[model samples]
Target: MLRTTIMGLCLAAALASPAAAHFQELLPSADVLPEGGTVDLDLVFTHPMDRGPHMQMEKPLRFGMLREGQTTDLLPKLVETVNGGKTAWRTSIDLKEPGTAIFFVEPKPYWEPAEGKYIIHYTKVVVDSFSTGEGWDEMVGLPVEIRPLTRPSGLWTGNLFTGVVTKGGQPVPYAEVEIEFVNDGSVTAPNDAFITQVLKADANGTFSYAMPRAGWWGFAALTEAETTMKSPEGKDVPVEAGALIWVKATDMGKAP
Candidate 1:
């Protein structure tokens, strides 16, 4: 009876633990390009805080870049690759003019058996070339997106990042937002709570977070889609549509 009681207690504790948050990463080689050059992008789906056990990412439904109020198709440029022993993608873009390149991806709906739902995260990142910083606030017309109230680029550590959670060009009031920093094997979390920071948007659909470390930070505003999708087992399930935006923070130090 004691053994069974101990086993039951362990099971209960495990069920109450928080799971690591999943983030779709759209990272660029450089957030700011002083001189025009090619910028390489890494597309991966994984838990940024844990930094391992990457989930396989299939070919995205759409991949494009928005600059100067124009969208350019980049799906054909994606090259399949492996990251963390899982399927991922890589692509590069050449920028010669002064503009803000907003790269975005609409990944195919991923089925999460553990969550019993389909996950689709519309991920994007801003890369400024020649430091023009123009059109940094332009929207890419994603199904779900985070409209940045604060400048997404040219940010220093400890800067407060603010954005509005929008779905179909409208604000989503009191949405839930998850924040995670891309762990570079430097800092360790004390416990599961430190793995992913969670917060709710205000009534205006706006949320903010101050980045403390110097690295890539991803903000994911999650919500349920109005439509449901058929699971692999022929059962309809809810969809977890996420609007994710990535920003880079640099330390205040002299340039080499």
Candidate 2:
């Protein structure tokens, strides 16, 4: 009886915390569009490292881009598509000029029974067009956001990427950040801990992480929402607000 009880408790603990990391994928075909080309973008909610079991995403509350201090609405252009065998969004945009375009998305509140709270990730990705590489540090003014201290594009493997976590335009010291890579089924984690690397900001709300491999890495700064929202059960519950950013790192080797 004691052995059975112990096994039951272990299962409960595992169920409470999942090994898969949830990331709002705001992936672009290329982070830097040389010569002002078109960019294919995919927006989805999933465990990027695992690349499976994607969660269904509703129409986003807001999806747009900021260019030269102006906001362009992109929500009307989103088309329904299947990503990782789940419903997701896909869109494309052409860069006509040389400048920086910061694309952002505010996903609808996602209800998770395991965490017993709604999650809303304000996700952004920077794309530099025509070698201009301008304004990569522009803030999207999200409720919770990671303002990139390092340039978000054109990073090589082993380069250290840094950002500042902010809430309501104020620094959030010691904010918890989660990191994950977009796995294409080529990598495997030795354990659950390796799946999602966790870090915290410093006293000044700055945090950095060095990438060991080349691919897309996502940084998510998590915080509890200021207000509660109604759950599916008609009860008010806390919300988890995440400030997410995606950066691509490249390998330094020449192609054979």
lDDT of each: 0.94, 0.92
TM-score of each: 0.95, 0.94
**Tens digits of per-residue lDDT for model 1, 51-158:** 977999999999999999889999999999999999999998999898999999999999998789999999999999998878989999998999999989889999
Ten-residue segment with the worst summed lDDT in candidate 2? 247-256
Could you tally the backbone clashes for each prediction? 0, 0
RMSD of 2: 2.5
By summed lDDT, the worst window of 10 consecutive residues in model 1 runs over: 247-256
